[model samples]
Every structure is written in C-alpha cells, then in structure tokens.
Target: MAALILDPLAALGRATLAACRTIGDVTLFALEAVSHLVRPPFYGRLFWRAFVEIAWFSLPVVALTAVFTGMVLALQSYTGFARFNAQSTIASVVVISLTRELGPVLAALMVAGRIGASFAAEIGTMRVTDQIDALTTLSTNPMKYLVAPRLLAAVIALPLLVLVADVLGVMGGWLIGTYKLGFVSAAYLKSTFDYLEADDVISGLVKAAVFGFVIALMGTWCGYRSKGGAQGVGGATTTAVVTSSILILALDYVLTEAFFAQ
Candidate 1:
C-alpha cells in the first residue's frame, strides 16, 4: 500500500516538473524574441509583408464572423427579452456583448486558426530545409529577421481587426433588429450608443492585443523548435493551431476577469 501511494505521488511530481519546464521554455523563447526585436538591422520589408498577410488577408473572415455573431446575438436576445416585454434593450445587449466579448474573442480565434498554422508550417519548413542555418551562417539572427516582424505585425494588426469586427458586429445587430426584429433603426442606434461605453470597447481591444501576441509567440516558438522533415512541419502546423486556440480561450477568461473584476 505504501509503495502504491509513493508511486502515484512520484508520477504527479514528474508531471508537475514537466509542465514547469514547458512554461520555462516558452518564456525563454519569448524573452529572446523580444530581445532581438530592439536590436539593429530591422526588416521593414518583411514587416510590411507580414502586416499585409496577417491583417489584410484576415479581414474578410473577421468581418463575416463579427456580422453573423451580432445577428445571432440580436436574435437570441430579442427572443428572451420579448417574453418579458424588454425588447427595447436588445440593442444594448447586442452592442455590449459584441464589443465586450464576442468580437475580440471570435476574431482572435479565427486569426489564430488561419495565421498561426501558416506561421508554424512556414517556419518549420525553413528549419527543416536548412534555410535557418544558412541565415545563421550569413550572420543573420533568425529571431530578429523572421520572428520579430511577424510578432510586431500581429500586435499591430489584431487591434485593428478587432475594431473592424466591433463595427461590423454592431452593424449586423442593426440590420437584424431593423428588418427581422421589427425594431426602428433610430431606436436601435440610440440604445446601442447610450449603453456601450468607451471602456467596454477599450477592454476588448486590449484583449485582442494580448491574444495576438500569444498566438504569434506560440506559433513561432513551435515552428522554431520543430524537427524531423515534412511530417514534422505538418505536426508543427497542427500544434500551432491547437495550442494557439487553447491559449486564446484561456487568456480570454483571464483578461475578462482582470478587466471586469469587482
């Protein structure tokens, strides 16, 4: 009996140590990336390309998700409020929910799914193909040249995407309320504006920025450390998406609590 108890305790201790080591590695990688970011030899062209790739290419999906989410929220909220004759609050509910939570969270998740996987696959391939090695031979810092630009671009673009998402989401609620829910456009707009505060919008954008950093960091770190060959690249790509998505969700809750804590 004592042996069994000790074995389980030892297993738990080992698992805890492994978790701590993984966290340490991720933190170390992030620190290195940040350190390289402030050094000389900035890559403007790479940064521009990353900005366009991560921001411009990502707009359509973000817009679509925001609009649909708003519409659905308006519909569901109207249904619940109608029973209590509180349908006038539909606009407020839609706006607050979208701006405070749905818009940023959904947009981040979408970007992580699309851009994170691409980052991992691209970087992992470079690692496997010796391109990263060639860069080092030429006295180039791979983290500075490759990772910093992507990280910077993600930080800059995600907030803009979230802003657009907020607008489109509100518009979606407007359309749904006016047409499907028999709400007057003027009343809907008034309620939205009256109830939605600047802090709510700012809080959501802050969450977007944090989520963007986590997504890019996780993707680049996974890709940078990837091994093997084509299969390794593929695995890294999958891991990037899965890990980024999970982190986005977990951080979303943490941020929400921090922002809204009483």
Candidate 2:
C-alpha cells in the first residue's frame, strides 16, 4: 500500500520537474534570442525578408477570416437582440467584439497556423540536416541569424494584420447590417464610430504584440529542440501549432482581465 502511494507521488514529482525544466529551457532560449537582437552586425536583409514573408503573405487569410467573422457576428447579434428590441446595439457589439477581442485572437491563431508550423518545419529541417551545426562551426550564431529576424518580423507583422482585420471585420458587419438587416448605413457607421474608443483598438493591438511573441517563441523553441529526422520535424510542427494556440487563448483571458477587470 505504501509502495503504491509512493510510486504515484514519485511519478507526479518527476512530471513536475520535467515541466519546470522545459519552461526553463524555453525562457533561456528566448533570452538568448533577445540578447542577440541588440548586438552588432544586425541582419537587415534577413529582417526585411522575414518582414515581407510574415506580413505580406499573411494578409489574404486574415482578411477573409475577419470578413466572415464580422458577418456571422452581425447575424448572431440580430438573432439574439431582435427579441429584446435592442437591434440598434448590433453595430456597437460588432465593433467592440472585433476591436477588443476576436480580431486579435483570430488573426494570431491564423498566423500561428501559417507561420508557426513553417518555423518549426524550416528550423527542424536545418537542425536535422546539420546546417545549424555548420553555422556554429563557421562562427555564425544561428540564433542571431535565424531566430531574431523571425521574432522581430512576427512582432511587427501581427499587429498590422490585426489592425487590418479590425477594419475589414467592421466593414463586414456594416455590410450585413445595411444590406440585409434594414439598418441605415450612415447610422451604423456613426454607432460603430461612437462606441469605439481609442483604447479598444489599442488593447487589441497590445494583445497582438504579445501573441506575436508567443507564436514565434513557441515555433522557434519547438524547432530548435526538435530531434530525430523528418518524423521529428513533423512532430515539432504539430507541437508548435498546438502549443501556440493554447497559449494565445490562455493569455487572452489574462490580458483581458489585466486591462478591463474591475
């Protein structure tokens, strides 16, 4: 009986220790990447390439997601508020929802799916192929050359993407409200503008920056540490996506509370 109890306790202790070690490793890796970012011989070309790749290539999906989300939100709001004769508030609801929450969260998730998996796969390939080792052998810091640019690019790109998504999402709501729900275009615009404070947009942008960091950190962390060969790369890709998504959601609640709680 004592052996059974002790065995489970020991297993739990081991798991806890392993988790702590993983967190430490990730923190150290992030710190090292950040340190390299401020050092001499900054890689401007690499940064530019990463900037274009992250920001430009990501716009289409983000726009589509924003438009469709706004449409659905407007539709749902109409459905619910019609019973209470509060339909005029639909415009306000859609704007606040997009600017304060959904736009940032959804845009980050899309980027994590697109960029995070790519990061893991690309770096994991480099690691498994001995390129990373070759870089170190040649006196090049892989973290500086590879990780920092990507991190910086993502931090810049995501907020821009979220900003665009915010506009497009609001546009989508406006379209549905005016065309389908018998709302006056002018009134909807006025309501949306009136209800939108600068902080609402700023809050989402802040969350976007943090989410961007999380996405890049998880992606690079998983890739940098990925083992084995192709199968390991695939696993790292999956892990990066899943972990980034979960962190985005968990952090969203924490940030919302920090910003909005009483």
Candidate 3:
C-alpha cells in the first residue's frame, strides 16, 4: 500500500517538474524572440509575408465565425430575455458580449487552430529536414529569421482580425434583430452604440494582442524544439494548437478579472 502511494506521488512529482521545465523553456524562447524584435538586421520581407499570411489569409474564416456567432448570440439572448420581458436589452447585450468576450476569444481560438498549426508544421518540417541547420550555418540566426517575423506578424495581425470580427459580429446581430426578431433597425443600432464604451473595445483589443503573442510563442517554441521525423512535426502542430487554445482561455479569464473586477 505504501509503495503504491509513493509511486503515484513520484509520478505526480515528475509530471510537475516536466511542466515547470517546459514553462521555463518557452519563456526563454519567447524572450529571445522578443529581443530579436528590438535588435538590428530586421527581416522586413519576412515580416510582411507573415503578416499577409496571418491577417489577410485569415480574414474570411474569422469574419464568418464572428457573424454567425453574433446572430446566434442575439437569438439566444432574445429567448432568455423574453421570459423576463427584457427583449429590448438584446442589442446592448450582443454588442457588449461581442466586443468584450466573444469576438476576441473566438477569433484567437480560430487563429490558434490555423496559424498556430501552420507555424508549427512549417518550422518543425524545416527543423527535421535540416533547413534550420542550414540557416544557422549560413550565419543567419534562425530565431530571428524563422520565429521573430512570425511572432511580430501574429501580434499585429490578431488584433486587426479581432477588430474586424467585432464589426461583423455586431452587424450579424443587427441583421437578425431587424429581420427575424421584429426589432427596429434604428433603435437597435442606437442601443448598440449607446451601450458600447471605449473601454469594452479596448479591453478586448488588449486581450487580442496578448492572445496573439501567446499563440505565436507556443507555435514557434514547439516547432523549434521538435525532433524525430514526420511524426514529430505532426505532433508539434497538434501541440501548438492545443496549447495556444488553452492559454487563450486561461488568459482570457485573467484579463477579464483584471479589466472588470471591482
């Protein structure tokens, strides 16, 4: 009995240590990449490429997700508030929910699944195929060349995507409210504008920036450390998406507490 208890304790201890080590490694990697951002020999071409890939290529999916989410949220809000005869509040709730929580969180999650996996696969493939070695041998810092540009791009791109998401999401709510819910368009728009504060939008944007950084950091770190072969790259891609998504959710709560806790 004692042996069994001790064994489980040991296993838990080992897992804890492994998790701590991973956190430290990722922190160091992120610091190195951020340092590259301030250092010279910037790779503007690579940065632009990453920006387009992350921002432009990602727009359609994010927009669709946002719009549908908004429409659904409005419908759900109407259903709930109708019981209390508070249907007039649906527009304000939609705006606040989208700008404060749904827009940023949903957009980041989508990007995490897309850009995070792509980053990990691309870099992990390069790592396994010796392409990363070639860059280092050629005196090109792989971190700067491979990681920094993508990191900067994600940090910048996600906020733009979230901003667009917020707009589209609100529009979706408006469409549903006016067409299906028998709401007056002018009144709904007025309610949306009136209840929306700059702080709500700003808080969401700040959350987007942080989520973006986390997404890129996890992607690059997993890719940079990937080993083995094709299997390893595939594993890294999955890990990047999973870790970024988890971090986005955890950080979202922390950020919400910081912004709104009284």
Candidate 4:
C-alpha cells in the first residue's frame, strides 16, 4: 500500500515538473523567435508565403462563416425582440454583437482550428523527418527560418482578416434584415452605424491580435517539441487546435473584461 501511494505521488511530481519544463521551453522559443524577427538575413519570401497562406487562403472560410453568423444573429435578434414589440433594435443588436463579440471570437476559433493545426502538422513533420535539424546543421537558425516569419505573418494577417469578417458579417445582417425581416435597407444601415461605436471595433481588433499570437505560439511550441513519429505529429496537430481554441476563448474573456471593466 505504501509503495502504491508513493508511486502515484512520484508520478504526479514528475508530471508537474514536465509541465514546468514545457512552459519554459515555449517561453524561450517565443523569445528567440522575437529576437530573430528583428535580426538580419530576413526571409522575405517565407514571410510572404506565410502571409498569403494565413490571410488570403483563409479569406473564403472567414467570409462564409461571418456572413452566416450575421444572418443568424439578425434572425435571432428579430425573434427575441418581436416578443416585446421592439423589433427596431434588431440592427443595433446584430451590429454590436457581431462587431464586439461574435465576429472576433468566431474568426479566431476558425483560424485557430485551421491554421494552428496546419502549423503543428507541418512543423511536426519537419521535426520527425529531421528537417529542422538539417536546417540547424546548415547554419540557418530554425527560429528565424521556420518560426518567426510565420508568427509575424499571423500577427499581421489576423487583424486584417477580422476586419474583412466584420464587414461581411454586417453585410449579411443587412441582407437578412432587409429581405427576410422586411426592414428598410436605409434604416437598417443607419441603425447599425449609429449604435456601433469606435471602441467596439477597436476592442475586436485587439482581441484578434491576441488570438493570433496565441494560435501561432501554441502551434509552434507543439510542432517544435514533437517526438516519436506519425502518431506524434497527429497528436501535436490535435493538441494545437484544442489548446489554441481554448486559449482564444479564455483570452477573449480576459480582454473583454479589461476593455469594458468600468
């Protein structure tokens, strides 16, 4: 009985230490990546590729998701307000909710699921195949060549993607409100514009940037540390998506609190 109890305790301690070590490694990697980003021998081609992949390639999915989300928001808002005979508030609700919360949150989650998983898988494959080691042997800093460009691309692209998402989402709301709900187009747009403050838009962009950082960091960390073989790569990809998504939601809450804590 004592041996069994001691064994479990030892396992717990080991797990705790391992967690600490992993966190330390990720922190170091992030610092190194940032340092390399500002150094010479920059990889312009790699940066452009990553930017296109993370931003342009993601446009269709983001636009589709945002449009449907706005349409649903309008429908739901109209239904809820109709109960109280306040249908005029539908435009304000749709715009505020989309701009302030849903647009950023959904876009982040979508990109995190898509881009984060891809990053982990690609990096994990490189690790498994010893490509990363080859780069190191060739005197190319893996942090600069592999990590920094992607991280920088994500940081820059996510906000732009969110801006597009916000516009498409509002347009979706406009369509639903005017056609499905029989609201006048002019009045719908006016209400949407009137109720949406500059702060709301700014807060969403801030959240997008934070989510972008988290997604890229988690992806790089998971991929850089992958071991074993194919199974390891697969596990890293799944972990990247799950962890990034959860972190995005958690950070969204923290940001929201900080932004609107008054």
Candidate 5:
C-alpha cells in the first residue's frame, strides 16, 4: 500500500520537475533570440522574407475567418438582443466582440496553425538533416539567422493581420445587419463608430503582438530541438501548433483581464 502511494507521488513529482525544466529552457531560448536582435549584422533579407510570408501570405484566410465570424456574431447578437428589444445594440456588440476578442484570438489561432507548423517542419528538417550544424561550421549563428528574424516578423505581422481582421469582421457584420437583418445602413454605421473606442482596438493589437511572440517562440523551440528524423519533425510540427494554440487562448484571458478588468 505504501509502495503504491509512493509511486504515484513520485510520478507527479517527476512530471512537475519536467514542466519546470521545459519552462526554464524556453525562457533561455527566448532570451538568446532577443539578444540577437540588438546585435550587429542584422539579416534584412531574411526579416523581409519572413515578414512577407507571415503577413501577406496569411491574409486571405484571416480575412475569410474574420468576415464570417462577424456575420455570425451580428446574427447571434441580434437574436439574443431582440428578446429584450435591444436590436440597436447589435452594432456595438459586433464591433466590440470582434475588435476586443475575436479578431486577435481567431487571427492568432489561424497563424499558429499555419506558420507555427511550417516553422517547426522547416527548422526540424534542417536539424535532422544536419543543416543547422552546417550553419555553425560556416561561422553562422543559427539562433540569429533562423529564430530572431522570424520572431521579429511575427511580432510585427500579427498586429497588421489582426487590424485587417477587425476591419473585415466589422464589414461582415455591416453586410449582415444592413442587408439581411433589415437594419438601416446609416444607423448601423453610426452605432458602430459611436460605441467603439480606440482602446478596444489597441488592446487587441497588443494581444496580437504577444500571441505572435509566443507562437514563434514555441515553433522555433520545438523545431530547433527536434531530433530522430522525419518522425521527429512531424512531432515537432504537431506540438508547435497545439502548444501555440493553447498559449494563445490562455494569454487571451490574461490580456483581456489586464486591459478591461476593473
């Protein structure tokens, strides 16, 4: 009986220790990547490539997601508010929801699924194929070359995507409200602008930047550490997507509280 109890406790302890170790390792990795940003020999070409890949290439999907989300949000908000004779509030609801929450969260989740997996697969493949070692042999810093540029690109790109998402999402809601729901276009537009605040949009953009950092950090970390072979790369890709998605959600709550909670 004592042995059984001790075994469970030991397992828990080991898991806890492993979690702490992983956190510490990631923190160190992030610090190293950040340190490279301020150093000489910046990789402008690589940063531009990463920025374009992250921001421009990812725009279409993010746009689609935001538009549909706004349409659905307007419909749902109208449904719930109709009972209370609060239909006029739907515009504010749609705008606020998209800018303060959905825009950043959904955009980040999409990017995490797309770019995070891509980063992991690309870097993990390099690691397994010894290309990372080749970089070292060539007197190149892998962290500076491979990680820092991506991190900077993500931080800058995600906010731009979220900004576009906020606009498209609001437009979607406008379409649904004015066309399908029999709302006056002028009144709806007025309501949207009246209740919307700069802070709402600013908070979402801030959240986007942080989520971008977390996504890039996880993707690069998983990829850089991946080993074994193609299987390892596959695992890292999956792990990067899953971990970044979870972190995006968790951080969303923390940021929301920070920005809005009294």
Candidate 6:
C-alpha cells in the first residue's frame, strides 16, 4: 500500500520537475535569441524573406476573416441592441470588439496555426537531417541565421496584420450596417471613429507583439529540441501549433486584465 502511494507521488514529482526544467530551458533560449538580435550579422535577405512570408502572404486569409467577422459582429450587435432601442451603438460595438479583443486574438491564432507549424516542421527536419549541424560547421550561428529573422518577421508582421484586421473588420461592419440594416453610411462611420479610442487600438497592437513573440518562441523551441526523426518532426509541428495557440488565448486574457485593470 505504501509502495503504491509513493510510486504515484514519485511520478507526479518527476513530471512536475520536468515541466520546471522545460520552462527554464525555454526562458534561457528566448534570452539567447534576444541577445543575438542586438549583435552583428543582421541577415537582411533572410529577414526580408521572412517578412514577405509572414506578412504579405498572410493577407488574404486575414482580410477574409476580418471582414466576415465584422459583418457578423454588426448583425449580432444590432440584434441585441435593437431590443433595448440602442441600435445606433452597433457601429461602436463592432469597432471596439474588433480592436480590443477579436482582431489581435484571432489574427494571432491564425498566424500561429500557419507559421508556428511551419517553423517546427522546417527546423525539426533540419535537426533530423543534420543541416543545423552543417550550419555550425560552416561558422554560421543557426540562431541568428535561422531563428532571428523569423522571430523579427513575426513580431513585425503580427501587429501589421492586426492593424489591417482592425480596418477590415470595421469596414465589414460599415458595409453590413449600411446595406442590410438601413444605417446611414456617414453616421455609422462617424460613430465608429468617435467611440474608438486610441488606447483600445494601441492595447491590441501591444498584445499582438507579445503574442507574436510567444508564437515564434514556442515554435522554435519545439523544433530545435525535437528528437528521433520524421516522427519527431511531425510531433514537434503539432505541439508547436497547439502550444502557441493556447498561449495566445491565455495571454490575451492576462493582457486584457492588465490593460483594463481598475
């Protein structure tokens, strides 16, 4: 009986210890990446390539998601507010909802799904195929050459994506309001602008930056640490996406609380 009880306890302790070690390792890795960012060898071409991959290529999906979200949000807001005779508030609601919450969160989740998995697959494959070792042999720092560019691109791209998302979302609401709901185009746009504070937008952008960092960090860490071979690479890719997505949602709540704390 005592042996059984102690065995489970021991297993739990080991799992807990492993989790702590992983957290420590990830923290150190992130610090190292940041330190490398300030050092020489900026890798401009890689940075530009990553920028295009992350930002420009991501536009179509982001635009579609944002516009449709805005339209649906406008309809929902009108439905709820109509009961209270507050239909005019729909524009403000849609804009604020997009800027303050939906825009950054959804965009980050989408990017994490796209880029996070890609990073893991690419890097994990490198680890398996010995390409990373080759880089070190050639006097190239893999962290700078491979990781830094992607990290910087994600940080830069996510905020821009969120900004575009904000605009498209608001435009979606405007289109729906004017065409479907009989709202005056001029009045809806005016209300959206009037009630949407700079702080709301700024806070979302700030969240976007943090989310971008976390997404890249998770993806790189998973891929770099992958073991085995093809199976390991697949597992790393899936883990990267799942972990990045969960962190994005969890961090969104923490950021919202921080931004709105009374």
Best model number under lDDT: 5
Candidate with more favorable, higher lDDT: 2 or 3 = 3
> Candidate 2: what lDDT?
0.95
Question: Which runs of model 6 end up more than 4 angstroms from their true locations?
Answer: none
The digit string of per-residue lDDT tens for model 1 on 103-145 reads 8899999999989998998899999999999999999999999
For model 1, what is the alpha-carbon lDDT of residue 220?
93
List, residue by residue over 119-219, the lDDT tens digit for candidate 2. Answer: 99999999999999999999989999889999998998899999999999999999999999999999999999998999999999999999999999899
Span of ten consecutive residues with least summed lDDT in model 2? 46-55
Models 1 onward score TM values of 0.96, 0.98, 0.99, 0.95, 0.99, 0.98
Model 4 lDDT vs. the true structure? 0.92
Deviation from native of the Cα of residue 186 in model 3, angstroms:
0.8
Error of 3 at 135 (Å): 0.7
Error of 5 at 50 (Å): 0.7
Candidate 3 lDDT (Cα, whole model)? 0.96
TM-score of 1: 0.96
Instruction: Give the count of colliding residue pairs in each prediction.
Output: 0, 0, 0, 0, 0, 0
- Candidate 4 — worst ten consecutive residues by lDDT sum? 94-103
Encode model 4's per-residue lDDT on 1-262: one tens digit a residue. Answer: 8999999999999999998998898889889898998998999999999889989999999999999999999998889999999999999998888888888899999999889999999999999999999999999988899899999999888999999999999999999999999999999999999999999999999899888888898998799889999999999999999999998989989999999998
Of 1 and 2, the candidate ranking higher by TM-score: 2
* Candidate 4 Cα outliers beyond 4 Å, as residue runs: 1-9
Candidates sorted on lDDT, descending: 5, 3, 2, 6, 1, 4
RMSD of each: 1.4, 0.8, 0.8, 1.4, 0.6, 0.9
Worst 10 residues of 6 by lDDT: 53-62
Cα-based RMSD of candidate 2: 0.8
Model 3 segments more than 4 A misplaced: none
